[model samples]
Target chain A: MTQTNTIRVLVAKPGLDGHDRGAKVIARALRDAGMEVIYTGLRQTPEQIVEAAIQEDVDAIGLSILSGAHNFLFPKVVELLKKEGADDILVIGGGVIPDEDIPGLKEAGIAEIFTPGTPTSRIVEFIKENVKH
Target chain B: MDLIQSVLNGEKRGIAKMITLIEKNAPEAIEALKQIYQHTGKAAIIGITGPPGSGKSSLVNQLTKKIRSEDKKVGIIAIDPTSPFTGGALLGDRIRMQELALDQGVFIRSMGSRGALGGLSRASYDAAKVLDAAGMDYVIIETVGVGQSEIDIVKLADIVALVLIPGMGDEVQAIKAGVMEIGDVFVVNKADKDGANRVVTEIEMMLDLNTEKDAARPPVIKTIATTGEGIDELNEHIKKYWHQIANSNELAKRRKERIRSELISITEDHILNQILSDKSSKIDSMVKDIYEKKIDPYSAMELLIAPEK
Candidate 1:
């Protein structure tokens, strides 16, 4: 029997960031790649993103944070997910983060960071290869 | 079994996992649901639907806050459309209720319509079941109410609130007939906008015309979701309707009807899958025969269903 499962992903925009063009584009691209993408819309808090991820039972969470608060916010999401015992969920960060910030983000439990100009296909491929379930 | 037990214990992850299983149509989903079936039917399932810009999400957010203030746990399912071409969905409804994310008493999920019209994805019903079993006092389903999908809400929810914003002339005309029949309560959201009372009047007139002597006419309440105005009144009406139905046979009848519909739908999907699965050769031959006019579509169907018969 073919045991197939849909790759459920939540694309969230965390913090006071109002820019969602990147998030929306990636969400549409992921959907086009045959994955179910739940776009949580603009201006989401880290707590909200984690809560949504847990409730939606998503395999991965794609955070689109354009604000400079990634250091505080991204780690907060990772921390919340861990506290809730959902550390198994794959976490990826995207949008306007410096190269130096990437190391800190990954260290904070973000599995991958995709900066600007990264094609949606790369993200899609990565998710397909890395989804835990 | 562990997951089901956790769901019954109101564990967020467990409830979420079960909803995901149902959405993916997992093979174990049926058995899992069966195990937790006895624990469901406790929460009041409320359906809120309206046009694209009717502020349904904002209204639901306000309603959730009110329900939480009364010390009730809430489960929310917001339905968004799936791209028929791509089979993916952009579920953005939960954004409006982000403030409730920190509150452990609230659980919100955004569901893709998954090609099932009637304003709900098939998985939504099961998600509600999971939430109900999780001991939520209310499970709110918010859907785009413009089309035929809204009718499905009346079947799944104990109370259906039809939300309309002022100045949506075409929207009112488009959904008036179907919505008038299904809405238990009519809400004029964005009441701060112009012509709010006109929309209310229009709904009242329709309700007056359609209500039978024995049928209770649905009350029309004005609300501005942005400012949380009139939500209390709307909440009261929802509670009142729940009370009226709880003591009456209507609740049981609706649940029975929902089960019947769900069974038929599942059976239909199952049989269709069976016919289509690994039967490419059979289907190709049938198609070729039909294209050549050697067999009609009806004859082909009969042949396909012959074994089952």
Candidate 2:
């Protein structure tokens, strides 16, 4: 069962993406929206991301990827979480992902994928509405 | 039982899940802890606390690497502050610790203060317990030292290392009152910067003033966490301090006091939940009366906590 009130989210920059500007902005947005945000920083592996999500007890995992490995890394995180019985954590992806890959990522269990120019408010709203609190 | 068994077997997922359960204060957390408690008390818990920007996280990262090099399994709990108004926290300590994220022997978890007044989450100690039960040789708790209440780390860590840096005005006096007695070791991180020796001297003088006859004074060391300089020395001091306290009655006393405080905190929360949830309880009326000045808070408090009729 989920904790009452606050929603915890893990904002991770995974798979060798050194550009953390987007991740940092989203992290601050989530914090300002009254959700606890754990930023795992850049260069995190998919294994590390899922493990962090589980330990932080995040309601959602927001994967910010830019190295063209979203196809490989994004689904790997969802796969690992599911393998560990943590499919309950809603997984979402963002950052430099193409529209063509969106369907594939969603099919791989990503709840939603936000591309560049997506409003922070929409992300916050989506989380508030979707997190299994 | 499955979780506990997996944790005992050093399964990373199991340890991670159990720590999450504790952080959420889920009902199953209690059951999990009951089973895990017996396997704990083996890991040497170290507390690394300092003011924000004092390089506490970097120091922990360096120390974790050193400990891992010695073939020791390490568990890290980094506690970041939560906004009182929003109940939100940005836990970025893992940024500095990214180097160890891939190490199988190093498990790092970032925890929000969760509005705990003491600069640590209520579940920090329990999370450390989970790591200890999972067979970690060293469990380091890094707290965001936001002045005053950072002393709470003493109750949870076997050795408390207070991190200090240069150029912070009155650096010694700022933490001296609230943190002095709690420190087992003192560290001057970012030692390559100017005024590092001054901070070291100040702490040494403070320790001298509080020295007890025949008691081991808290040792202070200097380090540049970014370059990992003096990390070996810092690790040596940590091990020395742990060795000195390991067999002492002081260690036992500290653990006992920790448990006692935790029990009281748990009971206080439980009673508060009960008071808030029972619509028939007089607490609501007492609060209204107090607000309207029909009764003073002291008298209202008595009525509010009085036995139910």
Candidate 3:
């Protein structure tokens, strides 16, 4: 929509969770869908994620948290981005998020939450449709 | 074109743009680097690596300050982990050295690991070369402190400083033998903490046990990174080691090895990209077969290379 060539996305895993099969799958899927995805690997902190988003000038940040520390980590990421005046960047999350906690996460400025079974196509479409730049 | 020319002339923004281009893995970036490659190799490259919570960023920040105090321009590449979902980076290390961001003499860039195993990014060596050619007095690379994989830093830096903090518990013991051997200097940070001395002693004992008879003994320095204690002494020791290496031809030998390593890494990346982008139906069918277990990965690879065979 913004006339950009590719939608740049930063896919990160926060805290100590080492499982990355899902993350890799999503990255490959996004790339296949003509998006530019920068996979940061595992064990990234909130600060590292924000700094990367700033430098990469990405359109969206997708945090995959399976470590149950989402409450602690996601807020910090949002806070840092806000502090850096990067609030315009879309923030979304996935990875074992519970149904009960979705509202709280959404209230914290997360644009969307995709669960484990969500199709990669749907994710790609959502990003392309919603993210302006 | 002017940007590329300025990069060749060793200007700061030009260097930053070159690194950004390289990290993007753009086609033109390679040409830009080739143009500037010959001007590289003047700066002292030091790698600061250790496990998370080892205070590597703080040490790098302090070292940058110390290096600048002596009127030396510094280029720092702090590698952060990339985002798995979005394929971006959360570069927290920049937060540690935010003050340096405002300094005209210091250039700091945070690079994402991009999931490249062995602790270093594929473009890191090239980026360092860009900094070196940019006329920085020193180039410091800080890695994400992830055990043995982090030892890859040794291949890129003239001096490798391993930072260890107090109260890491038994995690310190889990550092691989490869990491233990590559350290040219050891730092015990957070010296104000309770177990600082014990960590220092343990490192000393480990050094004594593992080092060769002819190898120079690596010095361990203690520091409270938050307050900048012991940083000046650490800088002095690092310079002392650098002078010794320069005078002994060790620096030249190390630089040769680093260049060789960079060539190998770049070639590997090129070959892999080529293989993936070759656009042959045979490779695709082979991958599908491998996924279906009709053939093993080794056989698939062999089949993919059958044209050359």
User: Which candidate tops DockQ?
Assistant: 1
Candidate 2 lDDT over B12-46, as tens digits, reads 87887788778777999989899888999999999
DockQ, every prediction: 0.62, 0.53, 0.05
Positional deviation of residue A28's Cα in model 2 after best superposition, in angstroms: 1.1
Model 2 over residues A1-133: C-alpha lDDT tens digits?
A: 3364678899988787689899889999999888889897778888888777766677999999888999999999999999978899999989998899999999999999999999999999999989886
Ranking by TM-score: 1, 2, 3
Q: What is the TM-score of chain A in candidate 1?
A: 0.96
Q: What share of the true interface contacts does each candidate keep?
A: 0.75, 0.63, 0.01
lDDT of 1 by residue, B177-295 (tens): 57657888999998888898888887776776773796667899999998999999999999999998889887888889988988998799788888888576799999999999999
**lDDT for position A4 in model 2:** 46
Candidate 3 Cα lDDT to native: 0.79
Better of 2 and 3 by lDDT: 2
Q: What lDDT score belongs to each candidate, Candidate 1 first?
A: 0.86, 0.85, 0.79
Deviation (Å) of B24 in candidate 1? 0.7
